[model samples]
Target chain A: MLPAAALLLVFLTYPLGLGVWLGFTDARIGRPGIFIGIENYEYLWSDAVFWLSVFNTLLYTISASILKFALGLWLALILNQNLPFKSFFRAIVLLPWVVPTVLSAIAFWWIYDSQFSILSWALQQMGLIDHRINFLGDPENARASVIAANVWRGIPFVAITLLAGLQTIPQSLYEAATLDGASRWQLFRYVTLPLLTPIIAITMTFSVLFTFTDFQLIYVLTRGGPVNATHLMATLSFQRGISGGQLGEGAAIAVAMIPFLLAAILFSYFGLQRRKWQQGGGD
Target chain B: MASVAIDEVYKSFGAVEILHGVSVNIEDGEFVTLVGPSGCGKSTLLRMIAGLEKISRGQIAIGERVVNNVAPKERDVAMVFQNYALYPHMTVAENMAFSLMLKGVSKPESDAGVRRAAEILGLVPLLARYPRQLSGGQRQRVAMGRAIVRDPAVFLFDEPLSNLDAKLRVQMRAEIKELHQRLKTTTVYVTHDQIEAMTMADKIVVMHDGIVEQIGPPLELYDRPNNLFVASFIGSPAMNLLRGEIATGGSPSFRGAGGISVPLASALSIPNGEPVVLGIRPEHLRLSDDQGIPVIVAVVEPTGSEVQLIGRTAGGEEIVANFRERHSFTPGETIRLTAEPSLIHLFHGETGQRFQTRTDQ
Candidate 1:
């Protein structure tokens, strides 16, 4: 017990205490200064660019999470079918998620680039646009592209989670539904969807958290570019502290995410509690 | 409500055949039970009738229409699974109303149907509860209600009472039989429990491996089983089989394993020296001190209502006799037990087929 307590103090408490201290003081990578009293937080509140980054993070997180969930459920259902070589198809479907995110993000960056991009080349060929489309160069398209990338990278996790839930459901339930004259759509609506709600909810919570704090994919793909259209709080924090030399303001901006994170945690708890009451209380 | 006719149907999975060419005529409003041990193709045959599995060959007609290619939803049949596959998400009322809703019945009519079925099953109080909230017996009732509300042409049950406790199984068995009597719907029930078949079935089809061993009324099969399998499978303690060869002379007899001669009915056409197996039910064996084959009493078991005596012949083969009261014999005591000649069954050893007896008395 003594050794475990010492390790926790050395590893967990030390890092958390250091971060909180840095949040208050104007501490940079190579230089440090005395603690500032709420000065950085004041700047964090007044900065329109910082607030825009927050909004972008929420927008990207919500859209990507919902799209991923829907596509994941669809993929799970398809994979669950009694098709030939089902495991092989399921493995192939997991390729996007299994590949390293940074590499896939870089690949997507090339595909969405202004010139010599396959997407632009195809659009030009199709005559949807007569000229090459500069997808990442525009703010709207950049945000959408980033959200799409996140969704692609995250969908397999959701699908695999819900697939496990689906597998636990007895095939007899569907047989009973068939005997009740339920159509294919009715079976999914009344049987599959209700049974999968808990799995989907848990997956959504994790997806929201991961997407909200997303950093690597955005950094590799857009670098929070196109007038900060694709910028998230994580990327903006990095830019403010490491690039703009506003270490105190960046720490304040990073700390500002605490309230939103806490709110998400509370929401997830309440949702799970409600689900518990609806399904059955406790184990 | 409808008759189901299975005509020479066969089913196989990949390279393994599970059901052989089998045929049975199920009359409308008849409660027929397909009974056999596990993996005897009973459930598979039921599923084929329900349009859940395609027949490898042959035809199944429900209510005069060949439903060989009909989808399960279009078959107009309701099935109650062994596990009582009630939807966990829906209330009992919703579960019962689901089939009517699918048929596009108006909400009020469907609700009334659900309520009527629930009331009949004594589940009106549980209509608002989800399946998980109900007990096993209650869930089973809900499953039956779900089927009842549909009022399909036929009710198919795939060992629906197997998951219940012994007491509950007996209770549900009577309930199901009564339900069948009240509804007067054609039903095909599948179970491995012989007691269930004997009690509930208007006709019982006993299957073994992948073939139908016999099909008849419960008493008909019990009193006159066509083959050794049916004889062994139909009874609770199971018929005792003793192997021997046919003996010739003034009084023809069956020579058991230890050269003990047991008299057979003279009407039986048993060739001399041909190997034959003799079958006798336990209840038919009487223990008396009369002139009969000597048996060594090996064990005695007394239930509250009856006593069961386990004995061995001088040749060291075992046989059982169920008595009406506690037996006064010790384990080592030698007793003489008589096998009534009329109750003895003779089967051809090579083919395991029962040889019909011709009596002119």
Candidate 2:
């Protein structure tokens, strides 16, 4: 316990405390600055680009998390079936997740490249497009493109975790439900959905947190490009604190994200609290 | 309620067949038990009857309609699984009502059905509780309640009491039997316990190696087993089998190893020196002082109602004898035991099939 406390104090609490303290000061790249009492946050409040980044972060996290959840749950269900080569397919599904984030982001970067993208080439070859798609050059397309990349990398986590959860449900329940006159759809709606809710809550919480703090995909693909339209708070924080050298402002932006993350955690915490039926004596 | 006719049903998984040409006729409202050892395909047959398993090459009819390709939901049956499979997330009432809900029954109707089943199973207080909250016996009752709520034509029980404790298993066994008596649904139950089959079934189908060895009332199977498997399987403290050949020279007698000879009933006529197996239930053997087969006593167990003596013959064959009147015998003591000629059973040594005698006519 002492060692764990020391590790937390050194690695987590200290860094978070320093960041929160820095957010109140007009700190610079190479020099410690005097405390300025929320000056950075006050400036960020009136800034349009900061508000735009906040909106983009929300949009990106919400859309990407939803997509990841739906597709991941669908994949988990398909993989749970008694298909041939099941383990092989399950292993293959984790490829996107296993690959390094930077590496996969780089791969997505090339896929979204305006001129030489394989997607564009295939579309052109199929006579579906007349010209190259301005994937990153267009603000809407860039946001969608980065979100798509995040979803691809995020799905395997949800799928594998959900698959593990799905396996815990006994096969006899399905047999019992079948004898109880449940149709195929009714079986899933009544049996599968209710049993899967707890896992869904946990998986989606982590997926939301990962998507909300996502930086690598955007940094590699768009770098908050197309007039800062795709700038998430994370990337914007790095841009202002490190690249733009406004350490105070960047720390403030990063600090502002805590409330949202806390909300997500609290939502999942309550969702995970044992339901009345789940609270019981030993089985 | 409806009769279930499993006519020449066979099941195979890829290359290995589990049930080979199995058939059983279940009358409407009759309680039948499929009893066997593990992997005897009794559960497989029960699942096939439930329409959960597809029959490879035969027909199963619930009532008069052949339900070979009918969906399980359309077959109108409810099953209680060995594990109870009571949906862990739902309350007892909800678990019972789930079937009616799937049938699109109205809320009030579904509630009435759940209430009725809960009352029948004595699960009224537990209707609001989850499965994990209930004891093993209670969960078992809830599983039955779920099935009872459906009011289907047939009820399928797949080793429902196997998971309970010994005392609870006996209690649940009686409860399930009583439930069947009250409901009068055509019930097909699967169990590996011969005792459960004996006590609960109207007709017990003894299965061995995926085939029906015998199907009869409990006492009939106990009194006259068709084969060595049934003889050994159907009875508790199983029948003692002594292998020997019939010697027809003087008096028809069984000549076993070590010069031990026991007289056979004169009504039986078989080829001279034909090898056969002799079967006698433990209770049929009586203590004798004079002419009888000599056995060296090994273990003595007294269960208040009866004394079970385990002894070995001079030929080194183990024999079990149950006596209603208690007598003390120490280990290694030689005791003489005998049975009436009419009580002895003879079977072909090679084929394990029982032979009919003149007295059987």
Candidate 3:
């Protein structure tokens, strides 16, 4: 306990405290500065780039999380069936997650390359498009592209977790429902969905958090580029705080994201976790 | 209520055949139990009746309809699973009414159905509670209520009481039997427990190795089993089977190992020196004063109603005997035990089929 507590204090709390402290001062690279309370935050409140990044962050998180959930749940249901080579397919579905994020991001970089992308090549061969797609050049296209990559990397986590939840449901319930005259869709609506809600809530909360703070895929693919259209809160904070040498301003930007993260956590806790059936004694 | 006729049905999973050529004719409003050991295809047979498993060959008819291709819901059967399988998310009332709701029954009608079932099952107070909040017996009642509310043509129970404690199992067994009597629905139940099969079923279908060994009334099977399997499986303490051969010279007698001999019915006409197995129930054995098969007492267990004694014969064959009168004996004491000649069962050694004697008539 002592060792774990000391490690948390030194690694987690100390860095977090330092970042919060830095947010209040006018500190720069290689220079300690005096306190300038709320100045950096006030400046960020009026900054247009900061606002654009906030919008980008919301759009990226919402769209990516939604896409990840839908595709992940579909994959989970399919994998739950008595398919041939089921374990092999399940393990294959987890490849994107098992690979390092930076490695997958690099792979996606090549997939989205302007001239050599296989997707563009296939489309061109099929006479679907006349010219190459500017995947990372246009703002909207860049945002969508980065979100796609994030969804790809994040789907394995959701799919595997949801597949585990699906397996926990007893097969006897399905047989009972069939005898009760439930059509396939009715079984899903009444039996599968209700039982899977708690797991969905937890998995989606984690997915949303991961998408909201996503930085690696965007950095590798665009560097929040094409007029900063794909700049998430995380990348923008790093860009302003570390790369731009305005340590205090970057810390302030990073600190500003806490309220939204806290909101996500609170929403999942109050809105999703407190189910009536879940609040009971053991069966 | 409906009659179920299963004719020469078979079930195979891949290349592994589970049930082979099984048949039973269930009368309308009859309670039939399929009893066997685990992995003997009793549950699989019940599932095939419920249309949960595809019949590999042959036909199963429910009522007047050949239901081999019919869907489970269309077969008009409701099943109570071993685990109860109550929806954990729904309250008792909702669980009972789910089938009615799926059938597009109106709100008031569905509610009335649930209410009636709740009352019958004594689940009226628990109607608002979830399945997890109920005790095992209460959950079992809710499962039965769910089946009862449907009021289907047939009820299939797949070892529904196996999960409960011994006391709860007995109580539920009686409740299920009473429910069957009150409803008078054509019911087919599956259980590995012979006692459950005996107490609840109007007719018992004893299965072993995926084939129907015997089908008869409870007492018929208890008094006379068709083969060695049914003889050993039906009785509680199980019949004591001794390997021996029939000696036809003079008065017929059974000569077992270690110079042990017992009298056979004089009217028996099996060939001389034909190897056979002799079977007798534990309760049929009585203490002999002078001439009897010699046995050394190994263990004695006295319940309030009877004294159960386990002993070894001179041939080292273990034998069990139950006596209503309380008699004390030391473990190493040698005693002579005997059974009435008419109460004996003889089976041919190679075939395992019971031999007919004059008393069987």
Task: Give the TM-score of chain B in candidate 3.
Answer: 0.99
Specify the highest-lDDT model's number.
3
How close is chain B to the truth by TM-score, in each candidate?
A: 0.97, 0.98, 0.99
Lowest lDDT 10-residue stretch of candidate 1 chain B: B352-361
- Model-by-model lDDT, in order? 0.87, 0.93, 0.93
Show pairs that collide, candidate 1: none
Complex DockQ per candidate:
0.55, 0.85, 0.79
lDDT of 3 by residue, B1-361 (tens): 8999999999999999999999999999999999999999999999999999999998999999999999999999999999999999999999999999999999999999999998889999999999888999999999999999999999999999999999999999999999988999999999999999999999999998899999999999988888899999999899999998999999999999888889988978899999999999999999999977899999999998999999999899999999999999889999999999999999888888999878888
lDDT of 2 by residue, B284-357 (tens): 99989997799999999999999999999988999999999989999999999888988888999999999987
lDDT of 1 by residue, B65-145 (tens): 999999998898999998888877788898898878878999999889998998899999998988877788998999999
How much of the real interface does each model capture, measured as fnat? 0.59, 0.93, 0.77
Predicted model with the maximum DockQ: 2
Q: Which stretches of candidate 2 lie over 4 Å from their true place?
A: none
lDDT of 3 by residue, A16-39 (tens): 999999999999999996799999
lDDT score for candidate 2 against the true structure: 0.93
